[model samples]
Target chain A: MSEFLVLVVPMWVVFTLAAQGTILSGRTGVFNVTQEGVMALGASVGFLVSYKMGSNLVGLLIAFLVGALVGLVLAYMTTQLRLDQFVVGLALFFATTGAAGLLYRQVIGVTMTPPRVDTLPKFEIPLLGDLPLIGDALFVQDYVFYFAVILSLVMFWFLQHTSAGLDFRSVGENPKAADSLGINVTWARTWSTVVGTGLVAVGGAYIPLPFTGIYTDGMIAGRGWLVIALAFLGGWRPLYVVAGAAFFAAMDVLGQKAQVLGLGIPHQFIEMLPFVATLLVMVFALRWARQPAHLGMNYDRESRLVG
Target chain B: MSTMQKSETGPGGSPPVAKPEARGPGILTNIAWTVVPYVASVVLAFFLGGLLIQLMGYNAVDALRAVLTSSFDTSFGMVETLHKWVPIVLCAYAFAIPLATGKFNIGAEGQMLLGATGGAAVGITFSDLPMVVLLPATLVAGVLAGALWAGIAALLLVRFRVNEILSTVLLNFVSFKLIDWVATRVWPDAGAGHPATTPVGDGARLPLLGSAPAMHSGVLLVLALAIFIAVAMRFTPTGFEMRAVGDNLRASMVNGVRTSRLAGAGLVIGGGLGGLAGAIDVAGVHGRMLEGMQSNFLILGIIVGLMARGSMLALPVVAFGIAVLEYGAGTMQLVSAVPVEMVLVIEALILLLLLLSDLVRDRLRSAR
Candidate 1:
């Protein structure tokens, strides 16, 4: 049971971080679907940089910066140029995916045996980790896990209570109104995009740095898309997004546990738990979910009409 | 919102010239406005791709030359290109149709997988049947399975108000596992080591067209379908309605068009074509359903559709262009040790440039 919790909790952290990024971008009126490809690039690039630098922390920082840079490009294209968000996002996804693969091949070369990295060290809290039942799952983990959870809380507080957060949400809800009120909608959305995508890259970097310690082409898998689903499931709220991530993560771990226990059911069906859960959650929970009014619209300050 | 229409370069941009008696220069200028930017984008992408290859310490020109000659120069390469063209063309059409009805059917990968699975399942099950019975049955099964998979998303969207984009994407993951189950457990080939179904009988196989470097006859089927789609979209009321709905959902609703129904039909047709692409791969190329045969067709098909800009006539040409890049990239990888994923880089660059070219086009028009 401890082993199961250990496996499940980290995934929750990774997914929570990703969902937070989605919410951030979505709040800024950019439906960034490039998460999957960005994560793939993050995994590959993060793994490569760490391997070369011999410092996991440095690799993660570089990964976050790279993601922010990509986000900057996406922001410029979508907001400044008045291009279609979905289309440009899709194009960015492809570009990042290809860039990752190309860079990997160029740097690593094709090898009969792929290389592996050491997982980030886990830190057990002094007293809190000694508690029964949930201690190990909650208190003992890599720094990234704590960062992910703390970041979510921070994001929730930052988005709800802060005046800057109100302005950000306003820019997303009605850019023209925000602009009329002296808010720079373009700057808010662009910064949100950069920060959100950077956070997403951290989630991506977590896959290789702390969780797997090895990078493969399929390392990111569909977790990036799952992050988007969870964000929607949480109604674009930070805390509920964490809960949604945890639910999907638990389902994923449970499926593996069922396979281990040989529960007489086909493992394939069990493997589908996360996706099915996402679908169910969306269908039932989305009724109460509120989206940014201009979630995927391109904003132009010169144009009086809402995009 | 309507009053804010500025000098934007996108779908709203119009020629600056006042109405004139001379229509010939106007049409030529319009054609140039569209064609020039697209051509420039494609050329830039190829040049950038070559530059990347050169930066990796390989001869960029050599790699590109190899791509051209290996995929189009020789008879074998030409035949292979045509063989590959069948699936690309079908998949692009699948994506294009959905876009026309304001649907983004990103589940082409899932639909294609189910199509292949359905084709192989029927083909192997009725191995004793004659060609006429077995072949058509397999194709029909493929089409139905693809449509049914897409229909799940459509139903969810229309009935429950679940977004089709999210539903379709979720359904793709489901289809991947479903196909895996079918290939590995349901009809695993007796002596085969990999996750694959038993081979289809000869009767279900598509006939070859030529002697040496023979291509499957599925190309003919795809061509006929393309022509039909072109005529339908160009001349028919149904196609016009789909386009109208795509243009403005609220306006179409106000105008009494059944937007939901059109959305469903677009998905069905799109998914069916995607399935047919997979079916052709099985019946024409592979002779059995194999795990991971879907490859990058979904993304490639979407890119092709986008490049075509909703023109049925332009779809095949774009698909061919993509096929060339894909095939050439493979050869480039072999010769220069460059990653074939570079094709994706080139495609994305082309798409981004094209999107930005609207700005460039507007600037040029204003200058004129």
Candidate 2:
């Protein structure tokens, strides 16, 4: 159980960070569908930079900047030009996905043996690390895991307790109302999307550091899509998202271990657990998953339409 | 929202309706308006792609030239391009059909694989049957399988209010695992040295046309289907309802249109077309279900569908252009050492530019 938790935690970080990023932008009416592509770009850039520079921290920072660049484009197109959010998001997804592969292939070439970097070192908390089964799994972990925990707490507090957070949330619930109340709709959307997208990239950058220490094509796989589902499953709430990420991460780890578990079932079916479970969960999740009212719709200040 | 509606209405939106005297020059200008943006976007995308190639230390001219000319330079290349066109266009229909009802189907890869698996199952089970009975059975099975696969997502969206995009995308991941099991466990072709099923019976194969490097008859079938789809979308009541729902959901619902049902039907039809692409590949090209057979067609199809911008008539044409770029990507790599991904990047650039062109056109029109 301890070993399983150890495996689940890092995967949890990936889900938590990405889901948080998704909801952050989602709360501003900017439904970011580019997580899959942006995450892949993050993985490639992170892996390459880590391999070349010998510093995973620097790699993650650069990944965040790159993801922010994409977010900037998405924000400009949707917020300023009033383009269709989903369409522009889909287009950016394609461009970034292509760019990820292009950059990796150009930098690494066709390497017979892919270069590797050292995984992030773990640091055990003094008193917490000495506890029972949960101790090693939860307390003794990498900096990113700790960061995910604190970030979630910070986000929950910021959104729930702060007056500024209410102003921000108002943009997604009713942008025209927010604008009428003197809140800067475009500013809220742009900053949130940029930072939110950057966090998603940071989540992606974490993927290479935890297990493989190398990046490959399709490494992000459908995890990026799963993050969107996670956001919905959590009702766009930070605390619930953290808990939901644990469930997704467990499924992820279980899928990876299916071949070795020897459960008398085909490993393929086991590998499909996360996606299938999400599909099933969504049927119920949507009942209470109150997404931002204007999610996936562009806000046109000059338009007479209610949205 | 305005951009999507504008794109659906075509480049300039239904020319003034009251200007009978202006119709003469209006027709020419309308044609110019449509043609110019497409041409300019393509050129600009290529220019950007060339710059990237040069920065990457490759010969941009050679890479760009190879990408543009290779499909026409040789008969084999042309045949390959046409073969690529078969799946690309079918997948574009898979995407565009649903978009007509304002639903996005991102599970074409999964649907195609399931279709192939279904076709292979039928073909393998009825290996001894005559072609007259077996071929159509295989194809029908594929279509049904594909439709069933998408129906799950459609059902969720209609009955439970689940997001179609998430459901469709998640189903794709599920389908990937499902097909892997089918190929490896159910009909494993041990000799193929890959996770693949055995080839279907000879009766299931599509007939070949012309000489060496001959084309398969599936191309002609898709050509016919394309014409039918274009006419149906423009003239049929169901198509009109789908368009109306997409253009304005509230108005459509107010007017007694069953918006949800129409959206569900669009997904099922789109999935059926996606399945046909897989089945055609089995009959015409690969002759077996195999891993990786989906071959980036999902992305190509989406790009083409978006480039067509909700016009069913433009899908096949856009798909053909994409197919040319896809077929030439390999040659460009060989000639100038530029990666195939560069073509994808270029295609994406073209899509972005085309979208930007809409904004520019809107701005200019308002100014005038």
Candidate 3:
């Protein structure tokens, strides 16, 4: 129905907007594909705190903070220990995934009921919301949507205009040059990933608090990795990244439409379209994308590669 | 990572550090040095693991005591450990072969899954066959499936210059969905009302070893495979060529070692062993291709491979260590009010410490 489209499209855009924040972090060279884990951690923490304090806002803040802390640990290993970034990221994934599943199981064992939450209600600006299609799409949404939109704008300004942004960019592009200039290359990566962690956790917290209204294992699934891929597809630009996310949102919302539209694919295969498309795009497009020269290198002041 | 930097190295501060001869040392000193770098790390991880148990408001000693006893004390526990270790050993050997040949294989899990599926299918389809005929066929089918799966990555790498790591991982996603399809559509087990194949018939079940607890002939096969890999790596011309290619591909090519063939051989053999592990798991543990049962199982293989350090001698020990950790985590969940997330936290800390310690060691050596 048109009503369903009216509802789904806008929410889909907001999800994409949130994913853009993740892509920005990737562009900044954090490479913390463990975003999914951070998100899950935030979801659990948010659920626990919101349940305890009866304050959804507080839960959101806690989720952001906790997710960042987990990122810091990841940053410590990847930045300081000089481990293989991919393996570190994968290990992070393993630990967090198992932890998330176990935590969910312990909390909701054998309980058939989806944990309930009084989700944040939607708000409408008095005048703009009155516009026929555009107004409703833009203005009438939950607090998370507006927050994400504002955050996107702020990030766009910050990444482009700030001195710290220049240092961060230098650290990503050429670590040797950054280090020669006395910029703490490790610190920049660590902080960017920390912020990335917070953003991802915010994404995760949305699930239990406002998105799904309950906790479930593998709920974020590979959306975290998708965010990483989406970042590259967006060319790490904020606006394009959001668009890329919306494209996925459309796929997500339309996933069930395969049956309705008689696309005649297995539900799983249809569901895989967005990810497969992204992977192919990434594989091909990656040949063209210029990476930060030190993208996943672990720098030890003492050790040098013979080559 | 926190080490003083003194970058100057020459007559003022060095002892002709550049020469190949300078790298050698007394036999005892060399052994001591290699052992020293790892000792602190392993000890630190073990200590921290204990500390975490204490931090969880439980007696660390009591928990570790139980774990140690469970892994070693009773014959039943010993058999359980060996039983659990067999698949892990095979999986590590499967991964380590290509890894030694300078290939990164993250698809061990997916390969194992296919092995399980393929072997189960063959076994179930031929359930009317004699036990001797059925069992070996199932395992062989698994090994072939694994090799064939890995062969895709190998073929692409050889022909198209595709990145094997990325391709293998992507293939994992494909395999997972394919698995889901199989569990849901092709081989639904009506009894469980869940995604899984029909229960494998008794003919496919592995024979237990002399009334030992869960110990099967698979462990003996694992031992034989370990000996085979170790001997191959140590003595064979094929292994020397593979090692030469790994050390320096261009140099080895110039020296007339066929790098391509070596790569193909390594990958095929690795995948075959991984397939064997999957087959063993199906025939020995689950008796059916069940969904969710193999989650994190491949990870155990990875951990074992890393800890093995390309040494087959180390594979059994690494596998045993992982089995102890896994069994401990399982036991803790069953017995205590402690959350199973504690196991995840412990594993995370262990990996974190492992990486951190290696970095620290490198830094310390440079400082010296």
Candidate 4:
């Protein structure tokens, strides 16, 4: 059980962080599909910077900043230019994927042996790490795992308990009304997109820091999309998203565990489980999922507001 | 979209009277607006791509010259471009069809893969059959496979209200795994080093267009499909309903259109076209199902679809432009030693620049 928790915790952190980012952006009426590509960019950049600087935090920070830069472009396209969020998100996705691949090749030339770096070391708390059942899994982790949990909690409080959070929700729910009430819908959207993508980049950083210890072309894989599913699964709420992440991550761990046990089933099927689970969950739970009212619609002040 | 049209139509089907002086831009300016800027954007993307290669230490002018000359300078290059144009155009239709009904189908990659797998399965299994029988059977199998793959998303949407976009994206991952399994476990090539299925039967092969460059006869099929779709869209009631659904779903629903059926048909047709692309690829070019061949086809298709912007007539032109860039990029890499990934970067850059320019143009127009 402890072993299982150890395997699942970091996955949960990364996924929930991404889900949290999606929720944040979605709450401000921008449904970002570029998370997948942006996360890839983060993973690639994180690995490169960390390898060069020999500092995990700096690398993660750079990755977050890169995500913010990309998010700025997205915000400009969706908010200022009033383009279709879906199409713009996809275009940005393609750009990031291409940019990440090109930059990686440029930074680390093609070789038979791919580069690797040391993963972030675990930090164990004194008495907390000594706990019998939950110590290593919960109390002992790298700074990222702790930071992810704390960030999720802070975001939960930020989105729910604060007046700013209420204003943010109001902007998402009805931007015109929020604008009339002086909420600065544009500002809300821009910040949410920029800052939200920063957290997403942190989620992406986990791919290199904990999971892989190296960057590969497909490192981010479908985790970004999975987080999107998780956001919807959680109904855009932080704690529920964490719970969804835990469940999804547990399934991921279970797949690995099954493979480790040398089960006769083809590893491909095991590899396929998470995506399949996502599809099933989306199909079953989507009807009841409480989506943001203006999720993918661009807010244009000049255009006649029509419901 | 229909709101503007409806308002212009006025009450009781009477058209609003046109004002002579209040008319919008002249036909020439409208044509320029539609054509010139896009042409310039493509040129700009090419120049930027050249700059990117130069920054990477290759001679930009030399690289760009080689790319242009090699890909479009000779008959062989044009044939190669045309060969590539088939699948790219088909996949563009695959993406655009469902998009016409306001549904996002990003599963063209998966559908194409499954379609190839199905085509290969049928071709390999029915190798003894005559050409006439086996070819159609293989094509039908591929189309069915693609439709069924997309049907999963369609079903989820119509029945359970699942977002098609998410479902299709997830299904793409699933299809990759499924294809890998099909290659390795289900139809493993006898003692092949890597996982792959047996080559398709000769009976299933598409006839070649010419001796040199070896373009497939499937180009004719593509032309036919495009014309048929254009005609149907222009003349048919079902097509009108699809446009209606696409323009405004709520209004279409109120007007008693079965939006669900339109959505289903559009997606299935799109999926079918994607599968046909795979079928043509295997039978016409590869003669077998190739692993990872589905790479970036969906993105390219989406790019073409987006550039076409719901106009079926514009698809071929946009697809041809992309095909030139793609084919040129390969030659450029080989000749100039630039990394082939630069093409993707160029493609992305082109899209971004195009969007920015369009936005700027719109802002300027509104200001005026």
lDDT per residue (tens digit) for residues B202-310 in model 3: 8898887776465788888888877877788768888778766665668899998878867877877888888888898888878888776556656677666665555
True contacts kept of 4: 0.52
Which is better, 3 or 4, measured by DockQ?
4
**Candidate 4: residue pairs that collide:** none
lDDT of 3 at B109: 73
**What TM-score would every model get versus the actual structure?**
0.96, 0.97, 0.85, 0.94
lDDT of 1 at A287: 72
TM for chain B in all models? 0.93, 0.94, 0.86, 0.90
Tens-place lDDT per residue, model 2, A1-307, is: 9999999999999999999999999988899999999999999998899999999999999999999999999999888877677878888888888999999999989988988999999999999999999999899999999999999999999888998889889999999999999999999999989999999988988998987898888888899999999998998889999999999999999999999999999999999999999999998886677888888777777777666
Reproduced native contacts, each prediction: 0.52, 0.64, 0.21, 0.52
Q: What is the C-alpha lDDT of each candidate?
A: 0.82, 0.89, 0.69, 0.82
Candidate 2, position B163, lDDT: 92
Per-prediction interface RMSD in Å: 3.5, 3.3, 7.7, 6.2
Which rank order by TM-score, best down to worst? 2, 1, 4, 3
- Across B1-368, the per-residue lDDT of candidate 2 in tens digits comes to 35322233332123222336656556767666667877888899999999989999999999999998999999999999999999999998998889888899998988899899889998888888989998888888889889999999999999998999999999988988998999999999999998999999999988899999999999999999999999998799998998888877889999999999999999999999999888989988999999899989888888888888777877798899999999999999999888898998899899889878877765765677
Scanning candidate 1 chain A in windows of ten residues, the lowest lDDT window is A298-307
Between candidates 2 and 4, the one scoring higher on DockQ is 2
Q: B1-368, model 4: which lDDT tens digit per residue?
A: 11211221111111112224645767567666656667787789988988778887889887777666776788888887877888888888888888878888888989999899989999999988999999999889999999989998888888888888888888888888888888887878866676678888899998887786777888888888889987787579998888778777789999999999789888888888898888888888778887787867898998888777577777877888778877887887778767677777777777777666665656666788
- lDDT by residue for model 4 over A12-79, one digit each (tens)? 88888888888999998888898898899888888889889988888899999999999999998778
